[model samples]
Target: MDLKSTVASIVDWPIEGVIFRDLTTLMKNPEALRESCDIFYERYKDKNIDKVVGIDARGFVFGAVLAYKLGVGFIPVRKKGKLPADTIEESYSLEYGSGTLEMHKDSLDVGDKVVIVDDLIATGGTAGATVNLVKKLGAEIVECAFLIELPDLKGRERLNGCKMFAMMEFDGE
Candidate 1:
């Protein structure tokens, strides 16, 4: 299926001049959602990933399922103060604005391989912050995966050389 066609485009959301690529529409469809998870599963089934670190909210949906399929652990990178344990945080800038993301301090160990998952990559702020948090805990980032990528924002540049993949691309208009 054309996954991009399954996504909804909401113009000027969360702020003016910013187009939001809403994945909920795709997620609501059984075929689309299953295809998304299957794509990631097929890619990482043999990568020996120790954990799937999903960004707050949307990331959790795909990350958890992928982790289960890969038989690995799942870690959550949430907004600051959401995790109730010793945690590390990184601040980032998104197309909409800026925010801080946090993850448990003990989520990973040195040399642990992880894949950071999210719904989309826009300004790359959220993914970048999550990458920092994973690196801070001494984990090795296998790759950052997203369902959609907005190239116009140059979010991938913010990843600092880490490898990344997106199932679909959307123009930033």
Candidate 2:
């Protein structure tokens, strides 16, 4: 139900020249959140998704839910050392600086198919890093999905080896 309108935009948040797409407004609305999940559900329910790999933090909210709805396992791609087991990491650049993301070494296996889910895609650094991490495990990325996308940030340009989908997109201010 017009989820884009439910999202909030905070200009220059946590950094300058970056308009943060805050999903909390949409998260706080039952109907909006339900619709958002339902959109992902309807798209992937029939696909072969062995796991829904969620990016750290914000991605967990929708990624876990989508995995549950799709009847697949949920895997979290967290920050360095966050996972208890042996892990592999992919360092990436952020708007302000650089950071790293990690996934358990045994979390995925060769030939497995997965969908990378997150709250948003902006400047694509994290998504690109996650894609590389999945590749290292020899898994096939079915697709990447997001609730929101900022085309102005050109995040999609940095991603590779997967189709991308989003529920809502905010561009050109």
Q: Each model's TM-score? A: 0.98, 0.97
TM-score of 2: 0.97
Off by over 4 Å in 1: none
Model 1 scores a TM of 0.98
- Across 82-169, the per-residue lDDT of candidate 2 in tens digits comes to 8999999999996677899999999998999999999999889999999999999998998999998888888888787578998878
Number of the predicted model whose lDDT against the real structure is largest: 1
lDDT (10s digit) by residue, model 1, range 1-173: 98889999998887888788899999999999999999999999999999999999999999999999999999999999899999888999887678999999899999999999999998899999998889888999999999999999899999988999999999856
Count clashes in each candidate, considering only residues at least 3 apart in sequence or on different chains.
0, 1
